[model samples]
Target: MWKFILRRIVVMIPQLFILSVLIFVLAKAMPGDALTGQLENNPKMDMQTLMEIKEKLGLNDPLYVQYTRWINHLLHGDLGLSYIHQQPVIDILAERIGNTVMLAVCILVLTYLIAIPLGVISGRWNHSWADKLIVGYSYTSFATPLFIFAVMMLFLFGFTLGWFPTGGSVDIQLEQGTAAYYINKMHHLILPSLSGALIGTVGLIQYLRSEIIETKMKDFVKTARAKGVPESRIYSRHILRSSFIPIAAFLGYEITGLIGGSIFLESIFSFPGIGQLFLQSIMQRDYSVVTVLVMISGVATLVGTLLSDIILSIVDPRIRIE
Candidate 1:
């Protein structure tokens, strides 16, 4: 497994290089840099001054020259400076990525915790009342827009009932590192996390339910039933395990996506997370931040694919990677 992972890592080198090139080129291609936008807003700044500013920032360099410098900095753990924030891109990311990771991880665990057993029961029951209820839940969540659901949650739970904070990740007034501070942070996260999880669980439920129902029709399940296997044992020991292969693969990709957060969801909740930061940087034309974020997302996608392979092999003994 270690050797296999190492081999996969080696394969990813070229892919990463390609991804970096695309990300950098595309970001640079976006018309107008931060300096241009800033200078335009300040009408007094003459074209010559703008040119001088661009030159100082090396924005006037050739594409190849800029890319070579950017890639070299990237290879050495330097993500460059954020044009909008006037700070290192990594520094800004360090401040925001944790919030996104924490929220995303909570959403992921909650989504699966609620989705898996509910899916199993729904599939096992097939056409029963409980199955209908779970199906209804999945459908409702599917139909509801993420932002609409997030807004409804914020209004009902946060604004109306006053059960949770309306927005933001924590109460800034509270003393950091204190027990109360942590509790308050969790409290603030509840609505957003639950909102995201509720929306996310729909696909998982559908996937698991369909897989389970399909698996039950297989000859092995019928053979077990014919051999006098207990219904519980057949479903628990045989069917449930077999049905998880696709779901595991699905979850591997799902985990990587959490790092990006939902722009609508995070924006609605005023959550200080990577998604919101990405949107802000884009509006401000922060090339460094935008490119690095895309690079990170690209890396995550590659890692997610690798994880899917590993998970598929784990869930199904027949799968092997050389």
Candidate 2:
């Protein structure tokens, strides 16, 4: 396992290099950069001033040179300055990432807690009323667009019912570190978290249900039943374990979603997280922030993939990492 992990980490070096290049090229390919957007409306900004600004930003440099400088700074732990925010990219990300991580963690926990058991029960009871009900629910949840769901939730829970705060991480006026402050924070979190979790849960329930049902039909499960094993034990000991492998893989991709997938949801909820930051950065053509965000997301994806491999190996002895 250690060797496999090390090998994967080693492999990721080149992958990340390629990924960084792609991110840089893509950011550069965008029609304009931060300076252009910032100065676009200012008719008083002359060509010479724009040229000087480009030089200051190294935008006048060849693409290769710019990429080299960017990557060099990146390697030295300097994520560069955010053109829009006038702050270090790292500092901006640090402020926002915590909120996103909190949101992601909540969504993940809620998804697995609700999806897994429900999937198992639905599979076990296949075609019964319980299964039918769950199937209907899954389809309904799956078919609902996240933005629409978020809007509906905000209206019902936040606007009309007045059960939860509609937006923001916390009430701006609330004193930090107090119990009421934390309570308000959690209250604000509920709708967005539920929005993310409900979307994720639908897919998880469908996948796990299929896996469990298939695993139940496998020869080993048949043998266990033929050997007079109790139904509960067969399910708990054999079926679930066998069926969980695919779910583990799905979890890896979901890990990336924790950060990346929250963009639309966050925008809808007015959540102060990296997703919102990402959206703003794109609109402003903030290359530094955008590139750093892409790198962070790429790293997260690689880590998640590695974690999934380790988890799969642990759960299924048959899945030995080479």
Candidate 3:
């Protein structure tokens, strides 16, 4: 297992390099620079001063040289300086990535908790009233746009009943680490986290339900039933245990989506996270910030896929990687 994981980690380097190149190229292709909008707003600025500013930001460098310099900085743990924010790209990412990680963890936990049991039950009674209810709920969540649901929830819960805070991750006055701080923070997170979890749960439930139903009908399941094991034991211990093979695999694939999908959900709630940071960088055309964040996401995807493969090998010993 260690060898397999080590090999996978080694392979991620090239993937990250490609991801960085793509992010750089895409950012350059965008319509404006960090100073474009600023210059537009300041028509009084002289052309020479504008050119100097561009030179200061290294916009005067050849694209290849700029890219090479950026890559070198990335290796040296300098994610390049943000042109708009005038801060290190790492600093900008550091400020926001934690919030995104927190939200992602919450969504993952909520998804597994809600999806597994609901899916198992739905699969157990595939044609029953419970199944119909689960199906309907999952479909509804799957079909709804996350932002729209967030707005509706905000209006109903925050505006109409006034039960929850509408936007932002905290009261803005809290010092950001105390218990009181977390309480206020979590209260604000509920809506955005719920929005993300709801969408994830819907997809997980459907996938798990299908996998479980299929697994439960296997020959081993029939043998377990024939041996007169208690129905609950046969279903839970046998059926679901086997079903988890697929569940783990699904989780590995969905890990990327769990993080990437937060862009819209976080934006709606005004949550400070990687997604929000990515959006801000895009608007400002901060290529350094965009590069680091995309690299992060790319590395995450590679890790997730490799982890899934490793988990599958462990769960099913018949599978081997050499």
TM-score of each: 0.95, 0.96, 0.94
Q: How well does model 2 score by local distance difference test?
A: 0.89
Residue 292 in model 3: shift from native, Å?
A: 2.1
What is the per-residue lDDT of model 3 for residues 16-110, given as tens digits with 9 covering 90 to 100?
77788888888788788767766777888777888998898788899999899988887888887887788877788888878888888888888
User: Candidate 1 versus the native: TM-score?
Assistant: 0.95
The CA-based lDDT of model 3 is what? 0.82
Instruction: Name the weakest run of 10 consecutive residues (lDDT summed) in model 1.
Output: 256-265
Clashes of each: 0, 0, 0
Of 1 and 3, the candidate ahead on TM-score is 1
**Which has the better TM-score: candidate 2, or candidate 3?**
2
Write the residue-wise lDDT of candidate 2 on 1-322 in tens digits.
8999999999999999999999999998989888887788688987789889888877889999999999999989999998788999989989888899989999999889999988988998899999999999999997888888889988998899998887899999999999999998888888899888888898889988998888899999999999999999999899987788888877788888778679987898999899999999998888889888888999999999988888888877888887
> Which ranges in model 3 have alpha carbons more than 4 Å from their true place?
none
